[model samples]
Target: MSPATCVFYGCRHPVERGMSKCSHHRNRAPCSALQCHNQAYARGRCVRHGARKKCPIPGCTSYRRASGLCLGHTATHSAQAKARHLNLPPSTQPNTTPPAATEAVDAEWVLGLEPMDFKLPPSPSWNALDSVDLAIIHILLQDTVA
Candidate 1:
């Protein structure tokens, strides 16, 4: 037999006939906590009855993610959320890590950290790239468009 929607008009949950709330509404179950009543949210209980998870950080009871950790706890997740808030793709977000020192101090760098879609031709100071190149790179990056 297929499950049906709850008989309670305000409630929108669906339930099987033999699940927790069969007495009041065979379609949807009520929370399973004894003598404490509210509609079941999931896992046979309501949020107040611990149907949902709490953030893993000690003493936190507010919001939580599926991993049961609080949001913004993960560095990558926080960065992604910031990118989303600013309407940018996570990939396009600016890199926070300082670029690793180049192995070729005197080598003329015509390419970017990634394979440059467009290479910069050799220039006077561009060779033996050091801190100054960062300003030039910043300018180039600011000017670049997809």
Candidate 2:
């Protein structure tokens, strides 16, 4: 009871219609490309766009999709490349997190030692601690025996 469908170009062969192809040339319509499902117009290429090339990155080859970088570098270099390619100001680039300071004070604090352990109370920056402190601490400990 239903109409027949056509299996030609731009055809929509519905099962109910029972048409071999769509409205287009059912017999003349060539097969779709292997790489793509679109109808093959020229050497497996549609009229609008052709088969895309692979990325030029070290080990990438999944369609030059975006920048010279591939899917792998898409997250890493895509944005950066775009910015640079557009000749944008360097200030616009994202800032990398600075490495944590490795000063001795930080390490000592982590160990949970007394404030004095880190030369607490902040030693006199201008004056260096000389032998005077040593002498005072060990003052006259030696005896002059007869």
Candidate 3:
């Protein structure tokens, strides 16, 4: 049986028996598994063929993502490193709940919107949140209040 053709457009090159793309089109490393035609996911072999390098520490199934340990270990390691470098123990989590409104109104209030012909709100705001974001926030506030 003939090997599959290259997946690239306008290319008629014949792909090798254990390769997906032709030599000209292939960019990533081929799977280390014998006769496997898939791309390498990590640690040499294809994803399905045990590509992830297991953590050196036992009882851990997660593969090594960053540093010498697996992903789960990396998070705690990062926390430890941060605390050690800063010379401070990890602080309590910051306040997350929004402040409750102090005043309670007897009557229901309605929010009204003025029509914009199709333009972003006035600018000169922070670069991260553009004028368009202000327009959207206005709409969202109107929705929640109503």
Candidate 4:
């Protein structure tokens, strides 16, 4: 018997089942991998085959970018976000006074108190004596006494 016919004109290949038409006749679907969608520099899309280059920023997807940002506001917005996260004063914050020299303003002060280190404190053993001591402390305290 002859092999199955290609849906595409002038082609003679077996069409895969469940697909509407043969590969040649069908439109090429773009790669679904995130690799095809560039995330760096805000470029969340492949240049040629990708769509949905919408900016990942909340509520803002005006234009597509080779990078996610449409070139005009990427760096500016990113730096501003970083500053916000680090508790540093926003660069975009409008000042009533004339801008001060960068060095004159204390960066640490602007950023606020230093973040607490993440180290865990030493774990104390919870034994019978600790429980007994806690019970005694509870018992000694009267309800009315401050």
Candidate 5:
């Protein structure tokens, strides 16, 4: 007997062992948030709405870390907090030193210093070719000559 297929439109996958719908189309309790179709994780809401721990920094919507700050803000805040605890004066001056310029070397100078010798291996003679190889060569030569 043929395997029972899912009834969902356009789906050809076999149904679960006893269920009417395929795994993909199986009935599930959706997220509590309106208009969302994702499966619920906790409190009848999806991960994004129910379990996500957002960064506490105002205006930042990034996910929170163990320190309760996003990756970028965590380092900045930690450094600043440490500096304040150490009683270090706040830096006010901007970096004024210009980056060092790199000089371009001429490719011709290197090529002139050492001339490269490229010698190709000698090609096999026509006598060393098989019948099939000779036939292909003959066809190519005929095309070129024409």
Candidate 6:
């Protein structure tokens, strides 16, 4: 029998024995690797050409950050944003200096009181009494003069 031919348009290359198409015209799955033409592994690239998620920034090899940029790019963008917000050139911005320290005052003096000299009024003992006793007391007091 005549050799099987490639089904693709304008291609007359003979197919391999017991196969559908010639080596060049065969429906070989491509690797996930950029511009790679090797057969795929289960529709993905092989281990030698494993796919990886990279930062969106061009030529950056670092892993992606929350904003799709690498860590270094993210920091650069943040600094640019801060500079824009302050309406100043990043290079011309003043250095941050620590604030001056102030004297500390006693907590008691701040509240206008002398500790241990002031005493709170004693708590009422009625809260300790039973509900029945309170009811009896209320009835007795209501029946008596003011």
Pick the TM-score winner. 5
Which regions in candidate 2 have their CA more than 4 angstroms from the true location? 1-4, 8-21, 24-38, 45-50, 66-69, 79-146
Which tens-of-lDDT digit does each residue in 1-146 have in candidate 6? 97777644345789777776578857655567776545556537643475435677788888765677777877666556545655797677534332123423334433645554544444343457799999999999988744
lDDT of 1: 0.57
lDDT agreement with native, every candidate: 0.57, 0.50, 0.62, 0.50, 0.64, 0.60
Give the alpha carbon lDDT tens digit for every residue of 27-125 in model 3. Answer: 767677777766677887777789868887779887777688876677566556545644664474222232134433212111123433443334343
lDDT at 16 for candidate 4?
Answer: 62
User: Candidate 6 has which clashing residue pairs, if any?
Assistant: none
Q: Which ten residues in a row have the lowest lDDT in candidate 5?
A: 92-101
Off by over 4 Å in 4: 1-50, 64-66, 81-88, 91-146
How does residue 21 of candidate 6 score in lDDT?
Answer: 58
Tens digit per residue, CA lDDT, model 5, 1-146: 98888664345779898887688878745577877655666677778676567788899988888888888787677556545644667784222232123433333332444433543333443457799998999999999776
For model 6, give the 10-residue run with minimal summed lDDT: 97-106
TM-score of 1: 0.30
lDDT tens digits by residue: candidate 2, 9-92: 344565234445454544343445544334656555654355456677767646665556455666556446545755779898
Give lDDT tens digits, candidate 1, residues 7-72. Answer: 443445574555543445664566788875577778998777878876766786756776556654
TM-score of each: 0.30, 0.29, 0.36, 0.24, 0.36, 0.29
Model 6 gets an lDDT of 0.60
Best by lDDT: 5
Q: Model 3, poorest ten-residue lDDT window?
A: 103-112
As a whole number from 0 to 100, the lDDT of residue 98 in candidate 3 is 23
Q: What TM-score quantifies how close candidate 5 is to the native fold?
A: 0.36
Residue pairs that clash (backbone atoms under 3 angstroms), model 3: none
